[model samples]
Target: MSGVDAFPGKGKVAHCDKEKFDLKKELARVTRERDILKKALGYFAKQKE
Candidate 1:
């Protein structure tokens, strides 16, 4: 009925799903790195004080 259905049997859906998963993984890694940097900054600030 829709454009997606028109291309049935193609791996378009699978590709999108994979892309979404990759983006989520990247976001999680970046978030973890940010948290670590924040903690390091806090520690240095305390040392300076």
Candidate 2:
């Protein structure tokens, strides 16, 4: 009834599911990259100071 499922059509539902899955994967990748960057930044900051 709400959020990525407003459409009742079969194709739409499938697309929504795929999109949700893709988003989850992308989120995980981005989170990992962000964590790596934070660690690198901290390392550089420590080296600089």
Candidate 3:
């Protein structure tokens, strides 16, 4: 039997070869922004004490 047919669930696999890299970059940028915002909020709260 051929390689494709050897794998039973191959037909169900979804391909996103083009957008995969962009998605990872976007996720990293969002995470960094969130961390920076949290630190700023903490600094402001401490100043009010």
Candidate 4:
């Protein structure tokens, strides 16, 4: 009763934690790609001048 038996919602908590981890990983990847696209856009914008 002192271990996992004390928390019946531990499974749900673990699932949420895993989902959060995956979201954060995807966010990082999207952010990196966005930055690259921004840089490319800037390069092309300068060509018009």
Q: Write the per-residue lDDT of candidate 2 for residues 1-49, one digit (tens) a residue.
A: 6867876565545777889999999999999999999999999999989
Which whole-number lDDT from 0 to 100 does residue 39 have in model 1? 100
The C-alpha TM-scores of every prediction are 0.72, 0.71, 0.63, 0.69
| lDDT for each residue of candidate 3 in 1-49, tens digit (9 for 90 to 100) | 9987787763654467437867898999999999999999999999999
Give lDDT tens digits, candidate 4, residues 6-35.
877635658778899999999999999999
Best by TM-score: 1
Q: Rank all candidate structures by their TM-score, best first, as comma-separated numbers.
A: 1, 2, 4, 3
lDDT (tens digit, per residue) of candidate 1 on 1-49: 9987887775556878889999999999999999999999999999999
Order of quality (lDDT): 1, 4, 2, 3
Worst 10 residues of 2 by lDDT: 6-15
Candidate 1, residue 31: lDDT: 100
Per-residue lDDT, model 4, residue 15, is 73
RMSD of every prediction: 4.0, 5.8, 5.7, 4.2
Show model 1 residue runs off by greater than 4 Å.
Answer: 1-13
Note the residue pairs that clash in candidate 1: none
Name the candidate that leads on lDDT.
1
